[model samples]
Target: MPSTPSIPPWDVHRPPPGHGKVFLITGGNAGIGYFIAEQLSAAGATVVLGSRNPAKAEAATASIRARVPGAQVRTVRLDLADLPSLRTAVEPLGAERLDGVIHNAGVALDDPPREETREGHELMFATNHLGHFALTHWLMPLLSAAPAARVVTVGSFAAKTERLDPDDLQSRKEYVPKRAYGRSKLAQMYFGLELDRRLRAAGSAVASVVVHPGGALDSLTPSRPPVHVRTAGARLRGAPAALLVQGKDAGAWPAVRAVLDPDVRGGELWGPRVFGLRGRPRRERVWTHLTDASAATRLWDASRDLTGVDPGRLP
Candidate 1:
């Protein structure tokens, strides 16, 4: 809300009851997303953990409920890699007036060959940006139905160093894993900031904000049975790599704050206070490209053309 907003974590950090509020999180099956689900559910909110696998979603919901007795949580199958899957995943959630939707599902292609989505876009772009664009577009009504709502877009530190090449979004020309990942994340921030401008122009009550969870470590974070399982890399728990990364619980703070913090404002970017690594949430300086209206418009137009969908009348 201010040039420099002050955020004091309440719901997620203090475990204050969220009571009647309904929030949906993509990729809630594991990683940082699951911790957000647990934090919100522990605070008494009804959380819908969206994942591609029903089994995994059930495990996540069960994990939260087990930890917080009588916690209200459910699961929905959502696959961000495919557009049709996202459409089907949102159907059941449309009936309720949602308090927030955290776009946290993402994929990082490390030294892997360039891949494409079912829709024919770059794998990272589709999963990280396009799918979320389509999801938010389709769910606008339910968002509008709420007295006031928020859309928390989980972004990455990559945005600061990388910019999207509107001329070639797919990286078909030349694929570099890190650059491709950065483009997708930058596009995500563009959407979040642009959506806020559009919502304000149309007199909508919903707000959109972008946040980056500091480097989140799957192995270093606390493990909950039947949900979080250790990987081979996890065996090196106290290694430098693990030590540098924050646990999933701390990493989930920025997004959770965007959804619950009263002081957070639309169109603002927030990240961990400690150099995008591990710390409490704070108002982080945004990349210059994110402030460009023309760039945002270009991203918005291209996203619509690629998805062949709209966020309904809200636009």
Candidate 2:
């Protein structure tokens, strides 16, 4: 085993021309995802936006076109909640060689006790991990088609404080809004590392990288609370307070860096360098336990069972 290499913060680098690369990003309609797509398109990459809402996706594309004046950006329908939709959503995209795939779609809320998706897995786990798992499994051929392709999965710092309960993955025994979210994020990071290992073992051309945003306050954060209570709470907290929240552009930097940085290696985790909370991107070591071979294998098996998608069958 060798020591992991570290990368400097985002401000240390300049955006290089993307030239003829093709990039795809999930949840590109808003927030961090949209910002990433904007930056990539501005860099000259052919960008494809994947979202559950076609209307919102169209609007996002329009906004990008307005900014870049003929930016090559398009949209595809993808709903992480529905496994069947995942298959249908990506079919029309055609099997073109891809330079990168940014797995950024996610959902978080204080909902009722553990709800399962049509795939029979916890909702958050299904969307945050299994959905991306299935997508990556299907896209391996396209990813491998490129001489050098990268798969960047958006993770979170919360994964550091959470642990996966193999027996209670659905949280049937106990459930908490924050815990569920954290666990799903933990799964995301683990999956990225494991996928990289498998790719290396098979001598594939794809490299897998994981990144976290620290905490970039977004519209999604405010939507967590009930509408009426959320309003009153905002009033008590002081109006316009949330307006000072961290910008999504800063949050998206790490993902962009992981995807496009020439020095980035497989299994490298990128996040803020300051307080691991908010700042520019930097390559940092994930918690030691996250790379534990046993746990990674366990997670890989669980994800395969849950999603019914096996990486071995992929190209």
Candidate 3:
């Protein structure tokens, strides 16, 4: 019998080549998502950028290929805000088994009275949490087929200060934009943790791990040309913030680690190394609020009802 290849020592700068592995990153065309896709592609992974816009996805793919010669990259039209579209989103993946999925896409409405999706769910909650929930369900079979696939959920630091009103998951009664956005991300964290619990109970091969990009600011991010252009003035302006917070590229580390790190287990939360805001990816203690099993279960149930996809109904 042949021994399995041993993983190389972990290096945040130069991750071990993914070779035959395939990874799907939601919103991989921009922000931290683009960096995740770029980094993973640089490491030889076949990266699929899930985006709502085809043209944007193409540009991201081109940028990645330009940066990393011979990079394997592609795009799929994925609109997380539209729940009906999710049911068929994975059909184009065309892989026998999916190695990992980084749930990196999200929406944050700054000034809003509050918005709802066409399905009438709150926009932020629909896109951030429930969309990924349904997509995960659709991707389960492909995920299950892998030797030890990982599902990485990118949460938010904004969630630290907010709590989900389980009864008002949609924020129908009183809708504050920032609070609603935070709550939506908090819901995603809950989904990630709860998914792990169910996966453990089911004896499944896939792992669900949660991660947060701490204080990822655009000004702090280095330029990625057409995708992102950080002017010198922008960099100078960002220098002060850079002391405590990191750029989007650095912000992408936790999720990338969650997906590629062999030792990373289900039910773990990872973030930045320096005060959970900057530097390398480090394992952080899960917040107490996030450990509410009752809330998690309730959110899971509500998500299933809302998304019309039960992740537990694994293929």
Query: Highest TM-score among the candidates is held by which one?
Result: 3
Q: How well is each residue in 125-149 modelled by candidate 1, as lDDT tens digits?
A: 9999999999998788889988889
Candidate 3 segments whose C-alpha is farther than 4 A from its true place: 1-9
lDDT of 3: 0.93
Rate residue 7 of model 3 by lDDT: 65
Cα RMSD of all models vs. native, in order, equals 3.6, 5.6, 3.1
TM-scores vs. true structure, each candidate: 0.91, 0.87, 0.96
CA lDDT, every model vs. true structure: 0.84, 0.81, 0.93
Regions of model 2 farther than 4 Å from truth: 1-14, 219-245, 312-314
TM-score comparison, 1 vs 3, better candidate: 3
Question: What does candidate 3's lDDT look like per residue over 32-142, in tens digits?
Answer: 999999999988999999999999999999999999999999999999999999888899998999999999999999997788899999999999999999999999999
| Superposition error at 77 for model 2 (Å) | 0.6
**Residue 3 displacement (Å), model 1:** 24
RMSD of candidate 3 to the truth, in angstroms, is 3.1
User: What lDDT, from 0 to 1, does candidate 1 have?
Assistant: 0.84
Give lDDT tens digits, candidate 2, residues 103-174. Answer: 999988677767778767788988998899889887777888898999999998788988888787767788
TM-score of 3: 0.96
Candidate 3, residue 157: CA error in Å?
Answer: 0.6
Candidate 2 residue-wise lDDT at 275: 70
